[model samples]
Target chain A: MELTNYVVLATILFTIGATTVLLRRNAIIVFMGVELMLNATNLALVTFARIHGDLTGQVLAFFVMVVAAAEVVVGLAIIVSIFRTRRSASVDDVNLMKS
Target chain B: MTDSFVAPTIDWIYLVPILVVLGTGVVGVLVEAFVPARARRTVQVTLALLATAASFATIVLLWRDPAVQGDPATGGTYGVRVLGGSMVIDPFGLAVQGVVVLLAFLAILVIADRTSTGQDAFAPTAAAVPGSPYEDLARRKGIEQTEVYPLVLFAVGGMMIFPATGNLLVMFVALEVLSLPLYVLSAMARRRRLLSQEASFKYFLLGAFASALFVFGVALVYGYAGTVDLAAVFQVLAGGGTPFADMPGLVLTGVLLILAGLLFKVGAAPFHAWTPDVYQGAPTPITGFMAACTKAAAFGALLRVLYVISLGMAQSDPAAQEDLFVALWVVALLTMVIGTAVGAVQTDVKRLLAYSSIAHAGFILVGIIGFSQASLRATVFYLLVYGLATVGSFAVVTLVRETAPAPERALVDATAGVVAPGGESASAPSAPTGGDPVGDDPSPAVPDAGVVLGEATHLAQWAGLGRRSPWLAGAFSLFLLSMAGIPLTAGFIAKFSAFGAAIAGPDTQGGGSTWVLAVVGVLASAVAVFFYVRIIVLMYFTAPAEDAEGVGVTVVRSRGPAAISIAVCAALVLVLGVFPSPVLELAAEAVKFVP
Candidate 1:
C-alpha cells in the first residue's frame, strides 16, 4: 500500500538494468539493458504520479515511452549495421579508436 | 454532459521562429521523398540555408518588437511564456538560437561543398558496404546522399528550441531530436566507413544511456517537486512547499543525476569518452557542425538550468545552492586538467580539437558558476566566437588531403582507379597509373585519372602544409590561435570577458574561490598553446619527411561554398576580436533568463 515500496522496487530494477549494461558484451543485450533501465524509470515515474495524484508525471511517462521507442529505432539500426559489417555482435570488438 | 472544454491560449508569435525551422525541416523531408535525385541537392541546400536565415531574421524582428521587450531586472515585458508555459521566448534563449542558426548556416555550406574531386565528404550510398561492389557502383554512378540536408534541418530545429523549452519533457525530446540525426550523419562519412560506423555505434549507445539517466533524473525531480516545469520546480524549491521537503536527499540526488546527463552532452570530463572518437570519425563538415552547434545548444540549456533553477533557491535558501556550485567547481577543474593534458599528446588533429572543445566546455562552466549577468553575457559571446573558429577550422581540415606513397599508388591505379587498401585515395593534380614499378620515386609518372581525396587527419601528414597551401594553413593557424586564447583573436576576447566576469562576480556564487577556476583556465590555455603552436611549427618550418611509409598530403583545390563559409567565419572572428563592443552590448542587454 505504501508508495515508498514501489519506489524501492523501481530502484532495484534500475540497478539490475545498469549492471546488465555494464557487464554485457553483446551490443543487442547492452541496448536491451538500456531499454530495461528506461522502463524501470517509467515504472518509477508512474508510481510517483499515483502518489502525487497529479497528471504531469503521467504525461512525462508518455513522453518517455515515445522517446524510448524512437531510441530503439536508432539503436537497432546502428547495432545491425555494425553487425553486418564486422560479422560480430560483441561491443568489445569495437576497438578501432582509443586514446 | 460536456459543458465546455477550455483550450489553452497559444502565442503564435512566440513560437514562430522555431516553427519556421521545424516547418522547413518537414518540407525538406517531403523534398527528399518527392524531388528528383538530380534536383534534390540544389533544392535541399537552398531550403536549408533559407530556413536558417529566415529563422535568424525572425529572431531579429522579435528583438525589435516593442511588445516583447522587457527589462531583465524586473523580468517584465521582455519575455513571452507560450504553449501553456511549455516554452519561453526570451532574449537570452533568442541570442543562443541566433548563434546556433548562424553556425548551422556556415556548417551547411561546408556540407554542400563538392570541389574536392567533385564529391562531398558523405558516402555516395551510406547503406552500401565499404569495398563492396555496390559501393563501387554507387561511386561510379556518383550517387549523393542528399538526406543529410533534411537531417541537418531537423537537428537545427531541435537545437533552436532546446534552450527555449520551459518544460523538462520538451527539453528531453528536443535533445533526442537533435542527437538522433547526428548519430546517423556521423556514420555516413565516405572515406572511413569502419571508423564512422564505430563512432555512430558508440555515440548511439552512450547517448541513449545518458538519455535514460536524464529521464530517471526527471522522474526523481518530479517525485520531489510534483512538477515537470522548470519554473514550477524552482518555485517549489524556493518556497519549501514540496511534499519531499523533509527528504532533501531526493532533491539533491535528482539535481546531481540531471547534471550528470547534461554534463555528458557538453563533453565535459568524466563523461567525454565519446568526444574524440566521434570527432575523429565523423565527416569533417559534420564534425564542425557537431562541435559548434551542439556546444552552443548544450551550453544554452546548461545556462538556463543553472541560472533559473538555482537563482530562486539562492534567494530563499542560499545554503542549498552551495552544493551545486561545489559540484560544478570540481567538474570545471577536472575538465580543464584532463582536456589539456590529453590534448597535448594527440597525433590526430581532430582528436586534439575535440579535447580542446572539452577544455573550452570547462571554461564555460567557470562562467556558469560565476553567476552574474556579466558572466552570462560573456558565456554567450564565448559560444559565438568558439563556434566560428571551430566551424572554420573543420572547413580547412576538409581541404587538406592525405596521399599514399608510389607503391600504394600503383596498386590503387591497378584497382580500376578506385580507392586503394584502407579505402584511401592519393589525391593529387598528377599521379602515375599501374605503370612499371616507380621504386624510390620522389614523383611518379603522371596518371591521367584523378584520385578521390580523404582528409589529412594525421599530424605527420601536415608537415610543411604552409608551403603546400599557405592561405589554408594560415587560416587554420588563426583558428588554433583563437582557440588558444591568443591576443587579437576572438578566443582571447572570449576568455578575457569570461575570466573578468568571474573575478568581478558576486561572492555568493563561489565566495571568491571562483577566481581559482579562472587561473586554472589561463594555465590550461597556456599549455594548450604548446600543442597548437607545435602544429603551426610543423606546418611552416618542417619539411615533408622522406619515410616511404609516411603518408603525403595534398591540398585540394578550393570549393566555392566552403571557401565562402571559411571567409565569413574568419572575418567574424577578427571583427569580434578587434571590435567586440557592439556584440558585447547586445549580449549584455539580452543576458537575462525568465524564470
Candidate 2:
C-alpha cells in the first residue's frame, strides 16, 4: 500500500517510453512511445493526487489525457502524410535535410 | 458534508484580449467553411489583421486602467490575479503579450502577401500529396489555403495566454495550443513539399517528446508541492516547513525536466536540432512567424519559471539554488559556442539565421540568469528587437528567388500567360520546371509549372543581389549587421543592455555572478559577426555569377504588404538603436510579475 511503489512504477514506464522513442526506427512506433510517456505521467499524476489528498493532480491527469489525444491526432496526420508521399514509415527515410 | 456548488467570479476584462483572438480564429474556421472560395483570402486576411489590432488595442486600454496597476506603497505587485489565481494579468506578461500581438500583425502581413505572379507561399491544398496531379490541378485552379489565418490566430491566442498564467496546468495547455498549429504549418510549404513534410515530422516528434517530459515534470512537482499553482509551489519550497520539504531531489528533477521542455521550444543548443531543418524546409513566411512569435512566448514562460525558482530558493535551499544556476550557466555557454561555431560554416541562408536565433536565445538567457528587474526589462527589449529583425529579414528572404534557365523561362512565361493575363508575368519566370529538385523529388509526375518559386538559399546564389536590387540587398545587410550587434543598430542596444544586466547581477544575495556569461556572450558575438558579415560581403562584394550560364538569384518584386513590413521593421530597428529610451522606459515600468 505504499504510494511510493506507484511512483516507482510510473518512473519505470516513463524511462521505457523514452528509450523506445530513441531506439525505434518506425515513426509510428516512436509516436507510440511519446504516447506511452504521456500515459505514464497520467499514472503518476493520479497516484500523486491520491497521496496528497487533493483533486488538482487528478484534474491535471484528465487535462493530460485530452492533450495526449489531441497530440495523437496531429502526430498521426503528419506521420501519415509522410507515409503517403514516401511510402515508408521509417525515421531514417525522412532525412532530406542534413547540415 | 456535501460542499455547496459555487462559481468562481471571473474578471471578464482581464480575459478579453485572448478571447478576441481565439474568437476570431473560430470565426475564421467558419469563414473557411461557408464563405465563397474566391473571397476567402481577402476575408480571412482582413479578419485576422483586425482581430490582432483589436487585441493590441485592448491590451493598451488595460494598460491604462488604474485598477490593473498595483500600489507600490503596499508592496503589492503591479497586476491583478483573475480566474481564482489561474491567470495573472501583470505588467510583465502584458508587455510580452503586446509584443507578440504586434509581431503577429507584421508577420500576418508577410503571410498574406502574394508575389507579382499572384502566388502565396502556402500549398493550394495542404492535404494533397506533393507533385501529385491533384495538387497541380488545385494550384492551376488558384485554390489558396486561406485557413492559415485561423491557425495563426489560434497560435497567437495560445501565446497570449502562455506568459500570463500562474497555474502549471494552464501553462502546459497553452504550450500545446501554440505548438500544434505550427507543426501543421511547417508541412504546408508550397515548394519543396517532401522537405517540408520531413521538417514537420521532425518538429512534431521532438516537440511531443519535450511536452511529455514537461508533463511528467509537472506531475512530480505536483507530488512535491501538492498543488499545480506556481505561486503555491514557490510557497512550499520557500517555507521549508511543509511535509514535502525533504523532497528537494524530486523538485530539482522536476524543474530540470520542465526547463528542458521550454529550452527546446526556445531552440537553445542540444535541443536546437530541429531549428535549422524546420526553418529551411517550412514556407519562408511561416518560418519568420515561428522564429519571432514562438521565441517570445517560450521565453516569457521561461522568465516566469526562472523568477519563481530563484526567488523561492532565496529564502531556503541555497545549495540547490546554486546547482540550478550552474546548470543554466553551462547551458548558456554551450548554446552560445555551438550556435556561433556551427553557424559560421552553414551554406544555406535559412539555416544560418536559425543558428543565429539559437545564439540570441543564449544571450537572452544571460539576461534571465541575472534575475533582476533590470534584467527583466532588458530581456523583453531584446525579444522585441530580435523579433522585428528576424521577421523582417525572413520577409526579404521570401523576396529573393532562383531564376529559371533560358529554355525553361519561355515555358514558364507561356504557362503564366495561359494561367493569368497580366503584364507582370513577363519578367517573373523563376518557377521550378527545369531546376533539379533540391532533394529527391517525391512526385515528379507533375511539373512545377511556374506556379510557385523557391527561394535562392545557397550562399553563392546571392553573389549579385546587391547590384540587381540595391535597396533590398541594403535592407538585408542592415538586418544582418543588427544581428551582428554592430553599433547604431537595434541589435547593438539589445546586446548591450542584456550583457549589462548580466554583469550587474541580481541586486540580492544567493543569485550567483553571471559576469562570466556576459564575457563569453561578447566573444560569441564576435564569432557570430564573421558569418553575418560574410553573407553581406557575398551579397555586395562578390560579382554576379556568369549570366550566360543562366542560373542566378532574382529579387522578386513584392506587391505591397511584404515591403511595408520590411520597411517598418528596418525603421524600428534603426530608431530603437538610436533612441531606445522610450521603449526602455516602458520595459522598466513593466518588469514586475505577480507572484
Candidate 3:
C-alpha cells in the first residue's frame, strides 16, 4: 500500500474525532474523541517518520502518548469530581456560567 | 547498516535558568510528599519565590554574557541553541522569560495571601464535594491547601520553557506541561466549585483539541521539511531544500493550524470561546496569573513563528507572505471589534475583565502586524504594562467581599429613621448586624468568618466603593485608567507605542493597510473607555447599594502579601507611564530572535 494512503486514513480518523468532540454531549465521550484525534496524529507522525527516514517523528509520537496519558490522569480526576457532585457527566449539564 | 550511537553534547550553563525552575518544581513536589502539613506552605512559598528570583538573576547574567551580546561591530544579538537546537536562548526569549518570572512572582504573592480571617483563596479539600459534610469538616479543621504552591511552580516552569524552544515537539510538550497544572488549579476554587470545575473541563477539552491540531500541523510540516526544527523548516522554505517545497498548500495549512493553537492561548477571537468562561470561573489569583503570564509566553512563541515564516516567505514566496498578512489583519480586526463590543455589556466584574483582556490582545496584535523591531519592542512593553495592571486589578478583586446581612441591625436602623445615600432605606430589616449604624461606612463590621462570602463580582455590588475604602478604590481606579489608555498612565504609553508601531510599518511590507487596524484599535479604546470609566464612576460617585437585603460589599484586609503586590503594580504603572524610555530601550535591545 502507498504511504500516502496512511495519511489519508489518518485524516479521516481525525475528522471523525473532531466531529465527535463537537457533537457529543457526554464529557467522557468527548474526551475519548480527543484521544482518538491524538492517536490519529500519532499514526500520521509515524508514517511521516518512515518517509523522512528520521527519528524525530517517532520520538514525537512517544511524547504525545505520554502527554495523552497525563491528560487522562488530570481529565478523569476532574470529571470524576464533577460527576460526584452533579451525578452527571454531560457537557451540557456542566454549564453553570453563561458563555 | 549498524551505526554507533553518539550522545549529543549539551551546554549545561546556558540551560541553567530553565533547569533551576523545573528543578524547583520537582523539589516542590517532593516537599509536598515529605514535609509535614503544618510547615509545607512556608517551605513551598519560600522555595518557589527564591527559585524564581534565582532564575531571573541567571537570565540577567546571560544578558551580560559576551556570547549573548554578540560582536559590538555587527550590532546584532546572538542566540544560544542548546539540547541539539531544541531550545534557543535569544534576547527576545530571555526578555519574555523575565516578564513571565516577574509576573509569576507577583501572582504568587496574591495566591499565597490569606484574608485577615486566615482564609486562603483555595478550598481546604479540593476533592470534597462542595457544601458536603466532608468539605465542612475540612474547612473547620483549617486544613490549608499547601499543594497549590507546587502546582503553580510547575506551571511557571512550563511557561519559562514555552517561549525558549525552537523545536515543535518540545513546544508541544511545554504547552501540555503548562496547561495541565492550570486545568487542575481552575477546578480547585474555594467558592463556586461547580463553575470552577466546569471551567476546568472546558479548558482541558478545548486545550487538548488545540494541541492535537498543533501536533498534526507539526507532522505535516515535518512531512514537507523532513525535520521538526523551526530553523530547518525555515531553511527549507527559504532555499527549497525539500522536494515538497512546491507544495505550499500543505505547509500553509500546517502553519495556520499551529497558529490556531497559539492564538487560542492568547485568547484571540474565533479561538477565544474559552477565555471569558475560564477567566470568570477560575480562582481570581489563578485567573490573574493565567491572564498575565500565559499571554506573554504565547505571544513570544507567536512572534518567533511569524518571524521565521514571514522571513522565509519573503525570500521564497511573497504571495504566501501577503496571504499570511491578510489572515493576521482579519483576526486582529475581528478580535478588537468583538472584545470591545461584547466587553461593554458585561455586568460581572470578572467577565468584564476577561473581555477587556481580549481587547488588549487585539491591541497587541496591532503591534505584531507591523512586523518590525520597533513593533516587537512595543509589543513586549505592552505585555509588561498590561500584565501589571491585570495582576493589580485582580488583586483588588480578591479583597472585595460580600457580607451577609445582620437582621437585627436592619430593624434598629429602620426605627432610627436612618436613610443610606442611595435613597434605599438603610434600616431595611435585612441590614447586617455587624454593619456600621450609618450604613455608609465602606468598612463593614468584620463579619464572623462564616458569614463572609466569596468575591463581590456583581457590578452593582461595587457601588460607592470609593467612599468605603479610598486607598483600594484609588488603586483600582489607577489600573482601570491605565487599561483605558488615559494620559499619564502606563496603559496610555503602551497603547501609543503599539499603535505607533503599526503606523510606522516595516520597510519591506506596504504598511498602508496596517494603519487601518491602528485606527480601529483607537476607536475600540474609545468604546472600552466607557466601561472602564463607568466602573470608576460607580465606585466613587454612585451610592452604596441599599443593603436592606444584607448583601453589601466589604473590603477584606489582606494579611500583607496581596496589598504589597498591588502597591508595587500601581507604583510601577505610574513610573512606566511617566518614564517608559528605559524599558523601551531594554525592549529595543532584546528584539532579535535566534533563527
Q: Using DockQ as the measure, which candidate wins?
A: 2
Which parts of model 2 have CA positions greater than 4 angstroms off? B1-3, B72-77, B406-452, B510-512, B547-549
- Candidate 2's displacement at residue B550, Å, is 3.3
**B41-83, model 2: which lDDT tens digit per residue?**
9999999999999999999999866556776567555688898
> Could you give the interface RMSD of candidate 3 in angstroms?
8.8
- TM-score, chain A, candidate 3: 0.97
DockQ of each: 0.51, 0.57, 0.48
Off by over 4 Å in 1: B71-75, B315-317, B404-450, B507-511, B547-551
Work out the TM-score per prediction: 0.93, 0.93, 0.93
Candidate 3: deviation at residue B49, Å? 1.4
> Interface RMSD (C-alpha) of each candidate?
6.5, 8.3, 8.8
Q: Higher DockQ: candidate 1 or 2?
A: 2
Measured with C-alpha atoms, the lDDT of residue B258 in candidate 2 is: 89
Q: Using DockQ as the measure, name the better of candidate 2 and candidate 3.
A: 2
When 1 and 3 are scored with DockQ, the better candidate is 1
